[model samples]
Target: MNDEASELKPSPKIDPRLLELLVCPLTKAQLEYDAVAQELISRTAGLAYAIINGVPIMLPDEARDINAVTVAQP
Candidate 1:
């Protein structure tokens, strides 16, 4: 049931070392990468920031809203 277009591949442009410096702007929480989900997860805020092509989407709208309900639905 997964959408092919929704699949986000890790960007060659993103430096792994730089990922260490990227923090969630909302909650200021450390982000962990979910390669399968192709997102950087803010565990505190429960938000998933999309990786578009090779770029990490730092914008708010580009981020997916997440919650227990959404997780359950997904």
Candidate 2:
């Protein structure tokens, strides 16, 4: 398959309600969806949790540290 086709492969869909119910395990803070990256970012915790097959891998060990990713203030 071509790169475009591979990228378009169907991934599991996460429910909006489920997203609303999920919080950062460490901080109990809300998560923002980074759809293109397939991650759930917790700004308060400075972590980005991976979403595998549409299932959020909420484990702290599986999350990437975002301390180096600077956010622009309004």
Candidate 3:
């Protein structure tokens, strides 16, 4: 049986080799792996692509705008 805490712990789903090979689909630029956030940050594209279930969602539409700012409504 696996330890409950260990099982619950979150781990990076992406592979190191794959990370090196993967790039921003839009800009063809290098991507920075964010293990904590489970995303690939593309500075050139100014986007953060979400990695779900060990799969990187490289689609632009699904990516979050890293440069976008959200203002709180008072």
Q: What local distance difference test score does each model get? A: 0.78, 0.91, 0.93
Q: Give the poorly placed runs of model 2, Cα more than 4 Å off.
A: 1-4, 69-74
Tell me, by TM-score, which candidate is best: 3
Per-residue accuracy of model 1 over 1-70 as CA lDDT, tens digit each: 5676556533445567868999999888788887767788888887889887768897766788776463
Each candidate structure's TM-score, on Cα atoms with residue i matched to residue i, is 0.68, 0.78, 0.83
Kindly provide the TM-score of model 3 when superposed on the true structure, using C-alpha atoms.
0.83
Q: Which scores greater on lDDT, model 1 or model 2?
A: 2
Clashing pairs in 2: none
Root-mean-square deviation (CA) per prediction: 5.8, 5.4, 2.9
In angstroms, the error of model 1 at 50 is 0.3
Candidate numbers, best lDDT first, in rank order: 3, 2, 1
Pick the lDDT winner.
3
lDDT (Cα, 0-100) at 22 in candidate 2: 99
Q: Model 3: how far is 23 from its true place, Å?
A: 0.9
lDDT of 2: 0.91
Report the lDDT tens digits of candidate 3 across residue range 1-74. Answer: 67997779786579889989999999999999999899999999999999988899999999999999999999
lDDT of 2 by residue, 1-74 (tens): 59999888876667889999999999999999988888999999999999998989999998999887668999
Worst 10 residues of 3 by lDDT: 5-14
